[model samples]
Target: MDASTVPGILDQAHRRTTAGLLMLVTFIAFEAMAVGTAMPTAVAELDGLAWYGWPFSAFLVASVVGMVVGGDAGDRRGPRVALPWGVAAFAAGLLVAGLAGGMAVFVAGRALQGLGAGVMVVLLYVIAGQAYDSSLRPRLFGAISAAWVLPALVGPVLAGLVTTHASWRLVFLGLLPLIVLGALLVLSAGRSLTAPDSPPPPARGRRWWAVLAGLGIAALQYAGQRLDLPAVPVAVVGAAALVAGLRPLLPRGTARVARGLPAVVASRGLLAGAFFGMDALIPLLLTSVHGYSPTAAGLPLTAGAVGWALASQLQGRFARVPRERLLRLGFVLLAVGLAATVLAAVPALGGWPAYLTWAVAGLGMGFGMPSVGVLLLEQSPEHRRGADSAALQIADVTLSALSIGLAGVLVAAATQGLLGLPAAVAASIAVCTALALLGARLAGRAAAPPRAAVPGAGTTLAAS
Candidate 1:
């Protein structure tokens, strides 16, 4: 169904469900942005540079496991059981990470935290898919997207200040209450939801063991970058691990250039990696070359956030159109943004361009990210929702690590060595742009014709 035909927000009937879902989404984004900002300081204090990747890695790996468990539990037992469990796990992780001391100890704490956060995140996706009717889905998601705007602006800087002054540990410890509150918000909606359990799922996809392998290999990839590990070994190990992990999780034809649900999932990873990999470099660039404070480096991302929010609202209007076309458009914008940032290498235009370029990338990203999200939800089976959601996150982080890790090499070569910082960043941006454009084409191929229209897909926008 065409999204343009849906009812706008004020005209809609279901206000409570939308409120709960949006609240959940906003909280998640808030937590994620806050954590990203604070971690650098936390790492410095703990002197855990060697294991720095683990904190984020822990969340991601555990989230993969949680996706499967939560999806299964939601499908068989219902989101009621899954959602609360998710919140509990995420909070537990936060509490532990906050209290941890020393690098090794902190890494352990992060691992536990990630496991719980993973499950909770999947449950949230299932909740979003299940609770809101079709017509409301897009706008609800858009609002969630909008919620991220300010957080991007403020989250990093605040995290920087907190780490620099009060306590980095406070960031995690503080989030504990918010996690509990978010869980309660969902729980309060009704009698706790519960789906009937079914027979056990077969191990044909990226199930229990495979998830560990995927994450392990991803960790190794990060290790490669951190320690100057050789590329051959890193690629060999990472490839082997990913192949093992993807054996069951992805739909057929996913690894190759292609179309369909599986392809959509894979493309999401590429796009995510391209953006995140490049994004990781942005702060480093601002701090090192631009001579901006950490908080100042974060400001450019805020512009991206603004662009991200504005573009999200327009997606429902484009929903009925071909998915690939939209995907391609998003990539084009990203490439353009990257191109602008690349110009930072040139001395005459360096200063202001640093801040302005990302706005373009942000806008392009805003257009593309939600489209993929709606597609993932649309394709998920009630039973597979958890797995799909988990897969989506896993793909995002895994690729992000690859992109970011690789950027370290390029940026270092350009800045640390002889090529020069601006030139190095330009090279880095160029690589990301190339990958993003390629991913855009893949998204195009993957964009299949929608199935028969839903009764209310048109009405989804009625509330806008």
Candidate 2:
């Protein structure tokens, strides 16, 4: 390619492609935020109180499977094949859920949606890796983070309005057409994008390992949610399954957080687990302890999103900063923010502190998440990018599910009078804080070794 022909993300050469990718992310973000707001009403109307958790759990578990499949397909073929199918599945799921008359049907639809979302996300990473040059990635990722800001601010409100004035089903149904448009944009761009032909065969039997890994993650999440029952035995079995299934799917040394790529991936899981766990609990804390209304309790979430977008912009602007340093700083901020949020459990502190504290945690996420994405691209070879992206996302979703489940158990115990509400909240906060701190420690190891080769770029993987 001629130097003059190389185009930036915003240039005419790439504008349509960038718009399409951003639109996809925006819609997904809206669905996630909107569904959370509408879920209580949806469940109540369906009279599915007993199965209230399954909608989310099913989506998360199915996503793991989608990630593995997408990774394999993208590596074997290309995003062109995987992406369109994912979009179709996602749209189908939306229609199913929107039209469903029962919670069981709704949960199944959510599982399908999760599968589609998982595949789409992994493919997006692959697309970004291939579509943009190294110089453009930070800006591209920043733009993607910016796409979340609008949804975070308005999705809940819009969903609430639609649910109250119209129907909860509209929330799901309304997104279908927009998703179709996004898919078209992606497919059009994919036609013009150049990608390597099918690579050498993948490791023999890897797909089976991927399947087992997905099942293990789902089983572990199920067991975590069932902690109220035979806690020890269920947890033990879940752990065993998770280990056996996860070991082969991840890069070597991921369990021990080896230097470079493995540590980067491990840090992503720890950061997401700690951050999202605390995020899920915030509204509960505000409503239960501070006596705020649902709408009012969600204000902090909006503020957090603002902080996240701002930090993401800052990180992109200062692209020369070492990604490892940014990740470390982000984790430290998250730990401090979570630690401060625990203080909100005190009656004397009042609810206002959360608006500020949680924003700090969001800022941390803003810094760390994009940095991790950049580092992953830096470390990965062309052929392995899809698989590595899958591993990164798997860690994120699995750890987040586990964290939320544990928090639920603690909250449940508190409701049952086994522990005080304050104690339960504090304990959950402590666990998340510890994870953040541990991630901070590991951030240093996330840096790629000096002179590491970019795979398929005609360089050897020799460390300086």
Candidate 3:
């Protein structure tokens, strides 16, 4: 389509592309929400209760590798190549998982799925940067966020139904065709687009560093889950490995939160870490403390998803607002929401009040997450987009893993009677709250003047 005739995301010309992207996102969202529901049954049937957490850990670690490799490939060859491969791998993973007779095989399948998911996420962002102009990006992201709403609301229920009537295997088997359908849509959209000229291949050394980083992240996740072991030494080794590997993978000065793009990247991690840390705990608090059923406990999560969609729509509608301002507002809301969730630890406020509090946290995520995405695109040069996108994902995933790991340790301690449940919950939420406030502080640094650009990179934004 000509520039003048380029239609909106919902217009006829863009309809197929939009539908395909949304459908892909919907399937991913459904799997993410549904897996937790089916896991209990899967473990029971396989007699793999001892290995319950390995599936999740394996997926997460393998995803880090996928992101790194996908980003490099996208920068060198284009997202067109990366996207289809990711979809194929994801589908294969589903088949493997569905057919598995044992836990080890199931974990391997999950790792493959995670790898594919990581690749897809980076490619999707690259696709968004390439296919849509800046004017259309916010709406596209908003739509992506909206796609999660339905899955969040019904995915678990649907998984439970399938498990009860047919088998949990259907949960994996059923998604294979949908993956093919989504891949077809993406490939069709890709046909009309021209690939950007490839940049010089990255140094072989950088690729090695990426592999090391992925391994480190995996080690850290494994260590976190194994807190029952000698905690101090395991944690120390994990931390050292994570830092050593992470140093070479990110932009220079990211560890120090250097102003501009580095700080923006750091802010994404902080926001994700704090938000997801709290999210992981909310259901536990409801079911264990408040005596709610599993389905009933999930209602707050549904409410949170609604709040997220609503906020995303508002940000998309008011695209004129400065992204940094929205980010700051989002962080403030997150901090407040986290603080409010601590009320559930209080005996008098344990039930319904917690739901509203968690919804506010979700609203913050809706605002902050998309704004970070927009800023990443705006800040990155065409050649660096893939690497920058990968960095963003790495930061988000690693920090979230660390945050949840720490919280798990605290919860385990409480369960063993080393601390009161109320105290454990309070302490965990407090740490997350502090991180949210820190993110708000970092948002200002992110808005500062960009550092000197590398040769062939995009022009830096001038400080207003």
Candidate 4:
């Protein structure tokens, strides 16, 4: 049946899949949101002041490799084969990190979690492509985005409270049981999914490239932590490796922001880089510069998340409003929010402004992020959905890492007395704001010709 005649996502036919998917996303979202709040305390306790960014960088680097392998597996044997392994790896990583006493072991566990998250998240797109119709896809993505809401509202605060009163270890250890439950639900719901009839293209080359990309990011992260001249050579090498690695992994013309799928892919990177680059630093900015407690530091994140969820729901409800317009608006808001957030760095302005500024940025992401997913799926050929999904995610992770690393370098400069903390933070926000504006400029390129409408679902948006 076409989407118009199909049951709604929460209806009997789709209830299990929808529930399973949302449940899984929620758990992941909680972990992601909570990590930022707990990280400072965790690093301090472990006595790893210089290694602050390594945990996050390790996760992002490992995720690239995971996405490559997971995409191949999903294409070959479907989500059934890929999903379980991803869950296993993620669980193992959490266990390791939770039990660790040192920074090295903690980072190692985070790497494993990144690998598992990479695999499972790619399969989510694969599953959506396989099981849902075009019309349903928008709603699915919207719901997926909304899954972050509850986590956003409470995850950071809860993490902060737990880290303060209890052990930070509980933050990692707490999620293990929930992970198993989500996996069981998704696996059971996905039992009917199967691989394509034809063999997929060879993934060997892509896998190798992904590894190279991971190494490159790791090098860059290392360079970011170092303030001396020795970091220059490492940064150059890392840049070269990253460029080489991304050439084959992303869509053709992605670097140049070519129209259609290439632009869509590029947009994801830019948007992610702009948003997450600032996100990872906000808590640090507040606690270090403004003297906010962990719980207080997490409030702005909650505000952003709330904005994201609300905007996603509205976009989903008004699915026919033209996704490109929403994307453009999203970028504008993100740019504005990011730029305004710089005010928080100035002691005269105070830290309260972050809540509002970040909320605006979150609204932008709420609109932009899901629209990108829907557009990609709409443009992707059925057989190549896994590969394309991998590309989209690769862009998100790669750009986010680069942006975060850039901010890390600035933070290092501050630590080493080369610049003031406020200046470093402002500089990082400025860069991210520019990226959001770039995304706005390229948003139209992601559009396609409108498709024929379903009876009451309304016309699909396309480039005029």
Q: Candidate 3 lDDT, tens digit per residue, 1-464?
A: 35456557877756777788888889987987898889999989989999998888778777877887777777777887778888888888899899999999999999888888888877777877887778777888888878867798889999999999999999999999997898788778666443557574654565566566666666666666654668667677767777776776676657777666777788889998998887888788888888889878888888888888888887887678888888888899989989998888876775787789888988898898888888888877777677778888888988898888878877888888899777888999999999999989878767646345444233321111
Ranking by lDDT: 4, 2, 3, 1
Query: Per TM-score, what order, best first?
Result: 3, 2, 4, 1
Angstrom error of the Cα, residue 87, model 3: value is 0.8
Candidate lDDT scores, in order, read 0.67, 0.81, 0.80, 0.85
Per-residue lDDT of model 1, residues 26-124, tens digit only: 666666788877778788888888777777766666666766666556666678877777777767767777887787767666666666656766676
Instruction: State model 1's lDDT.
Output: 0.67
Q: Give candidate 2's error at residue 281 in angstroms.
A: 1.1
- Regions more than 4 Å wrong, model 2: 1-8, 192-195, 202-211, 220-231, 450-464
- Which ten contiguous residues of candidate 3 have the minimum total lDDT? 455-464
Report the lDDT tens digits of candidate 2 across residue range 248-329.
6676666677777877788889989998888888889889988999888888888888888888888877767898999999
lDDT of 2 at 232: 64
Give RMSD (Å) of candidate 4 vs. truth: 4.9
After aligning candidate 1 to the native by TM-score, how far in Å is the CA of 319 from where it should be?
Answer: 4.9
Model 2, position 290: C-alpha lDDT score: 84
Q: Which candidate leads in TM-score?
A: 3
Residue 336 accuracy (lDDT) in model 2: 89
Cα lDDT of candidate 3 equals 0.80
Q: Which residue pairs show collisions in model 2?
A: none
- Candidate 2 contains a number of clashing pairs equal to 0
